[model samples]
Target chain A: MRKNDMRPDELLKMDRRLVLSATGGMAAVMLPVVLTSFIVSETARVVAAVLVYAAAIIMAWAFVKRYVGILNAQHRESEKKHLSEIAMLVQPITTHLNNRALIIPVLTNQLNEVTKQTESAALDIGEKFMSIVQRARNQAKKASGAFGRFAGNGGSSSESLTDLSKKALSDVIESLRDMVGVTSQTLKNMEVIIEDAGNIKRIVTEIEYIAEQTNLLALNAAIEAAHAGEQGRGFAIVADEVRKLSDRSNAAADDIRKLISRVETDIKGIYSKTEKSITESSARSLEAETVVNDTLRKIDDVIGEVKKQLDELGAETESLAKDISSIVISMQFQDITRQRIEHVIEPLMSFKAELEDITQKARSMSEKIHEWEGNSSAEWLEKMYTMESEREVLKEVLKNG
Target chain B: MGKTVLIVDDSASMRQLVSFALRDAGYDVIDAINGKDAMSKLNGTKIEMVITDLNMPEMDGIEFIKQVRNNPGYKFTPIVMLTTESQESKKQEGKQAGASGWIVKPFTPEQLIDIVKKFAR
Candidate 1:
């Protein structure tokens, strides 16, 4: 393995192996040289050989120790370089994770605030709408009540318009009948007056007849006075005066009879005209009564229609109020939606917390790369199952698997 | 005077929704955030009924119902559990804790009012 990739303990074991192999090879070579010198049987030569071997063995040991130290120094340098590279790579990721962790909570909080405000505003609008609907219902009820009072329905004490109109027409018809009765009575009186005039005419005729008879008697007396001559001369003079008086009486009687006839004719004409007028007035009065009754019937029909329409209006307003109330009830869905949103936000918060934990671990790992060992699979798996759905899925998978 | 009901839930929206439904149904309503808050609000005010959610912070519905049953004044008051939990075991737990009725979440206003009328009456 590359020195930087190798663990410090593995590098230490390799260094120990290299030092043992060098010492064993140097000992093999020195032992043989010392054996050969001892076999040569020369003391001075043997001593010099031993001295050279000792110096050579010391020099070899020193060289192996220095080489092991250089290898260890290189391994330390490589380890430092690897740790620096890991820190460089982890810095940006840690920062990104930290930033996301910080932002998620704020974002979720803002979302929660917005949701609350929207819910409140929507609830307020619903309340106001309900208030308006209630007010409208009350107003409609008031209007209907007033109309009922005007129509005299529902035990109102005041007379209805229909009743008032009928009553007024009835009074007019009664007055017309009264007038017809009076006119008929006046016509009957006129007839009676005409009959009395006829009686007076007959009386005048009798008077005329008496006056004629008296004149004749006066004429006879004058004739008798003439037949007795000279002694009857005074009586004849008186008789002549009586005869003149009788002639004037006859002329006045004739004038009186003619005046009575003219008076009877005028009375008959007045009676005929008044009787015709009374008949025509009675007919007109009946026709007017019929017309008034028809008008009253029409007024009743119109008022009945108006009252029906008002009742329908009241019913429709009540139905509308009920519909608005149902709408207000339907507004409760907002609460359900809000609960669902809360469910969603809970997992998001878990994810944010998990991310923050990972970032902290990453920072610690970067600082101690040489000593760092990554998290376990189970630890990561535990974090992955933050939501209930995810945990359910995992359960399903385990059951199936 | 209308009967009073208390609603307890961690969700504000849910509390408001229950409050609105109860108030519209001609009953007075009081609301609390959780079981602990609900416990504090039960100060001998003659609450006829209680509606509570299953899960909450600090204290939960089961424990809350137990506490309520311990109170002498509210021992007979009807307590209904309103929750998203549909598990039979959880329901049994709630029943054992003295819940009078159980209602799943997303309930209609009519259903809630009907339940209230039945139990509160």
Candidate 2:
């Protein structure tokens, strides 16, 4: 497959096939089979000529053999190219396979180590951090709940207060309406009272006129009675009394008209102020409604924000919960890892444990290590420990004996 | 003394989740939405631990980690890759990028707390 192992000009060998086929052409010309048929046919002499011609044909065939040298050289070069191409294709694959074989075990060990560490860490974390997470979640829940309660309380109360304000404003407006209605009635009643006052004034005027007429008549009668001298004196005195009564009646009617006029003036003043107050109260109620609407909108916005926060908090707590479950699964791995590692290192660990303290404790170390490191089935270690324990027991028995 | 941890994840829920576990283990929590946000927070804040998601919309976790380690402030800070990946190549890449360690995702609240305590503390 080396490059130089093959000669150059490998493709030129295709011409050798053409050269070898060209040799068949000479058979036609040299054999002259048709010519033989035209001439005297055949015998040893003709056969000798044929043999000589065949010899020439054989000798000329050397040219064809020479062409194979080029062909072989070309073949060799192509074989080399093919071999190199194949090598190019295979090299990386082989390298990869080998690399994988080498890396798998080592990587698996490292991964296992990582798995073990993560597990133990998880257990330690689960035992330690679970409470913390739970506590945090609990606290968060509590805080959110408190905030929610506070939000609900504050929002509702504010809403209530605004509502109450609105209601009070409405009540005031309604009361004002009633007041206006009553005032309007009072104004109408005042108009009627004013008309009555005018009627009283007209009646008083009539009474005055009647009184003047009656007084005039009574005077006439008194004058007439004077003319008749003594006989008429009694009649004239009676007429004078009648005139005095009419004057007293006129004075009383005048006093009643003055009282009515005073009342009408007071009513007119009150009606003017009441109309103005009604207009002001209506404006105030409208202003109050606008303020309530604005406040309500603000409170609604705050509630919306709080609700969004609460939703976020809820999702976070749920995520925290999921994390806890994964951690627990990791703890299971931790337990298995602990046993696996303990078994792998039991002898070493036991030796360490021994150096620390191994009197009565040494007796249980085998079983303890066995139970702890279940994956490590070092039966020989177990046998060795059993022999030691048995020997110790025998010594004790002998001493007691 | 508790560790200060900064969680950088696009999801608000995820950040809250990590914050809960970390804060519970006596760690103070800081948060960022993505790598750019984390970088900004880091520049403005003091944090020794950062838990970040690998895949994010703007500035993924890997690039962020690389940038963080390159910066003077976070040369030795523990940057734990919190992800749902188990690919060795990705881990190798993370290692190459100067990740301190990795924690697989969908982790239990307890496990996350444990891991944060282990690395952060």
Candidate 3:
């Protein structure tokens, strides 16, 4: 109803109900008397019957009219009360829906923002993890390659080193054997020379003895020559020739003895020097073999150490690769979590949509209530009255009144 | 050349995880960002097995599996779905698409390797 539309404030306002009761009582008293008068006066019966029917019809019409007014007034009051109650219910519902609608979008936006940020962060972490894993894998590959190369080269070098050591030992032994052969040959030659020198000394000594004998014979001949003066002169010349030959033989034997002594001394010095050289060469050959063996052993040790270090490096790289891989695996939690969050957000999005729908419904309901408020009581009753049976009851009461 | 395994996932982290695990187990791993990318990478490669995610940007795992089954080269190749989805309907779809198995997310590397070994080798 319009806000300015008001009920009457008069203390004595006669409603349709009072008019109906008064008219109903009058009809109740007059109807019976008029019927009895028609029985008593037969000649006037038609006129009295017409007057009674006319009075009854007029009272019934007034009663129906007043009762209809009562019914309309009650209907308007009930409609207004119902509309007021509906407004009271719709206001809070609209408010709640509005608040929820506002809050839901904000929540959805925040969720979206958070989801975006989480996704970005997860991507960042994944990229970093991939980088680390890639670097680690590359390093492991390089280390493995290095280790393989080192092992390969170490094997070949070790073989080469062993061959070299064997060759060096063989050369040393061969050189020692050559020195022994040369030294022995030199000694044998010196021995042969010494034997020949001895033989020469023996021959010279024999010559000297011959020369001594000749000298003795020459002396005897000279004595005999003194006894037979002139005849002995020819024999004395022969004896003197023999004495000169003997002296020359003795001088040559002395020269041969001196030469044999110096030759023997020189041969002894050469033999001593050759013996010393052979001894030193044998010792040096042994020392050289030992040195070569030591060097080979050192090379072997170095190769073994290098191999061990390479193996260790390979192992470390493998371990590092494993660790980086594990870290990458751990970082996968972000993707899983992101998917989980998206799953949760799916329902949340549905809920938001439902809330929006509810908010829209509430808004429409509120608008309907506001439109209802503009309606007059009669209009509301005409539009909202659904009880045909109640109208029939109201008509009967109206006719009885 | 070792046994080759193809890993398909939109998530880089998941791909890296699978790649690292497979590579560590002495298998050659080929990873792709999605099913479409996996298909592109699958060309001319001797792939023994495939591990793919169900949800992806271009082509999904089921469709990818179906495509792989359609291809003459990969018709008999064992394809497995790696995903967070455990729904029976999705699994049935994968199976219908010629998938060999399903492995859920957050799975252990050993679990993956064991499954790969079972099929790839």
Best by DockQ: 3
lDDT of each: 0.78, 0.66, 0.76
Steric clash pairs (candidate 1): none
lDDT of 2 by residue, A1-401 (tens): 34454346632444455755676556546565544555564685588668766765675565455555545545544554564555555555545544554554564566558665665555456656567557768877886776555455444454444356555666765776676677667667767776776787788788888888888888888889899899998998898898787678667766766776677677667667766765676566567556656765676676667767777877887677666645544443443454455455545444444433433343344345434333222322333344678667655654675
Worst 10 residues of 2 chain A by lDDT: A375-384
TM-score of each: 0.64, 0.37, 0.70
Best model per TM-score: 3
Tally clashing residue pairs in candidate 3: 0
Residue ranges of candidate 3 with Cα displaced over 4 Å = A1-92, A98-260, A263-306, A376-401, B1-3, B26-28, B40-46, B87-89
Taking the true A–B contacts (Cα pairs closer than 8 Å), what share appears in each candidate? 0.37, 0.10, 0.41
How would the docking of model 3 be graded? medium
RMSD of each: 13.7, 30.4, 8.2
* DockQ, each predicted model: 0.36, 0.05, 0.50
Error of 1 at B16 (Å): 5.2
- With candidate 3 superimposed using the best TM-score fit, by how many Å does residue A318's alpha carbon deviate from the native? 2.1
Flag the better candidate by lDDT, 1 or 3. 1
- In candidate 2, stretches whose alpha carbon ends up further than 4 angstroms from where it belongs are A1-124, A127-231, A304-401, B1-121
Across residues A1-43, which tens digit of lDDT does each residue of candidate 3 receive? 3333435642123344566577677766677575757476765
- Write the candidate numbers in order of decreasing lDDT: 1, 3, 2
- Sort by TM-score, best first: 3, 1, 2
Instruction: Name model 1 segments beyond 4 Å from true.
Output: A1-26, A29-86, A154-158, A174-292, A368-401, B1-48, B53-67, B84-93
For model 3 the TM-score comes to: 0.70
